[model samples]
Target: MLLAVGKAAGPEKTLTERYVERAAKAGRAMGLTGFDVRELPDGDGPTRADREAASILAKRGRGVLVALDERGKALTSEEFAAFLQGFADDARDVTFAIGGADGHPPSLRQAADHVLSLSTLTLPHQLARVMLAEQIYRAVTLCIGHPYHRV
Candidate 1:
């Protein structure tokens, strides 16, 4: 299963919905089978809600945790493909956590098995969601010998 936690803020509400819908569709096309997206209640400061949701989702699967953070390791597409292949080989269920505007709470970062960087530059939280979904679809496609990945 693929689990993501995101804030329900920024952008027009309808635009956000559309991006999420596109992501879900992309996930389906990639044969993810189980894709779960959770919207956490907006918090005044850093929220522990993503971590809490992650823990719950983690219990439902084998728990290969990957968090998207600017400070994490940056991987090329091939590297990402290799990482996913290794996870699949280990028969682990992967959960990719996307945190809120303030970024992931300290506890969540510490709990993550793999902290990944999508880019060095910061991205808007909502845009990150759509980018992550697309990358996931791309990664899965690469793994399955799909021609969708040019590299």
Candidate 2:
């Protein structure tokens, strides 16, 4: 599941839905279940990000936890595919968390099993959500050796 803070609207929402749907269909074909996106309300102030982080951690599962941050380690699409495949092979679940405007706090980063960055550049929360969804689709395709992820 992809946990994102803030409601997605307009083009961002459309693209996100498009990729998520694509991912769901392809994933189902490959026996990957539960491709769902959960949206959370955005908060404010200095504690907003921390509050959101806490909420995410609490809501996440016992499997692999990944926090999205601009400074996190970057991975190639193929590498990401392998990373997720390793967990899938182990029958472990994976959850991805996207923080709000203030970004994830240090505690959240430390608590996450992996801090992943789609790009080093700072992206808006909604756009970041779209990127994540698309990458997830790509990862699934790559794992199944599908054409969606052409080298």
Identify the candidate with maximal lDDT: 2
* RMSD (CA, Å), each prediction: 4.1, 1.0
- Report the Cα lDDT for candidate 2: 0.89
| Best candidate, TM-score | 2
Expressed as tens digits, the lDDT of each residue in 1-151 for candidate 2 is 8889888899999999999999888877667776788887787887999889988988888888999999999999999989888877787888999999999999999999999999999999999989999999999899888998876
Over 59-149, each residue of candidate 1 has an lDDT whose tens digit, in order, gives: 5355687878898899988788788778667756687777656677666777778889999999876777767766766676677777878
Q: What lDDT is reached at residue 14 by model 2?
A: 94
